[model samples]
Target: MAKKVLLRVYGMTCDDCVAHVKNGLEKIGKNVDVSLDGNAVLDIDNDFDPYKIPSLDVFNGRYKAQVKEIKDD
Candidate 1:
């Protein structure tokens, strides 16, 4: 089952920061869905791999998550 999650990220001081976040999320897998405005949303289908991502602490920001919305597709 797929679910939508909202992530609040801080320290995105520039567009490159956004790109870095996007690249990090995309590297997780093609099966996952994600987006970023200021924060990021992960529409998860299954448990995700944490190892695939480098430490986000590099971004120096807050990361918070919650279920936001769900869509059937």
Candidate 2:
């Protein structure tokens, strides 16, 4: 099983920040898409708990992440 999750990210101020977030998300799964507007939709594995989504620590403590929505796929 897989899950589609929407994430709300904060403290991203540029393309570099976006890249950092993208990299961090990639560490968890391959199907991750991030937008400039501080939003991301990820296709993650069933075992990948959305609640465990990392914070700014994944990006050198310069950002924050929260789950906005999640659904089974």
Candidate 3:
């Protein structure tokens, strides 16, 4: 099973931030679409735990992520 999730991201100030967010999210999902406007959408495995969504520490704590929605896909 697969799930489509909408994420609300914060602290993205530029394109570089978007890239970082996209790359980080790709580790957990596919079809990653990240925007500087503070949103991202992706398809994740059903077994993927939403509670484990990273704090995006790859960017040195510059970003935060929260699940806004999730649905069967």
Write down the RMSD of all candidates, one decimal each: 5.3, 1.8, 1.7
Q: How far is 33's C-alpha from truth in model 2 (Å)?
A: 0.8
The order of the candidates by lDDT, greatest first, is 3, 2, 1
Off by over 4 Å in 2: none
**For model 2, how does the per-residue alpha-carbon lDDT over 1-73 read when each residue is reduced to its tens digit?**
4888899988888998898898888887667899879999888888878788854357458788888999888
Give the per-residue lDDT of model 3 (tens digit) for 5-35: 8988888999988998898888888999999
TM values, all candidates: 0.51, 0.87, 0.88
Candidate 2 whole-model C-alpha lDDT, 0 to 1? 0.82
On the 0 to 100 scale, the lDDT of residue 58 in model 2 is 78
> All models: lDDT?
0.48, 0.82, 0.83
Q: Enumerate residue pairs that collide in model 1.
A: none
Per-residue lDDT of candidate 1, residues 1-73 (tens digit): 3444455555565767666666665554334433445656554455653332334443434432333444433
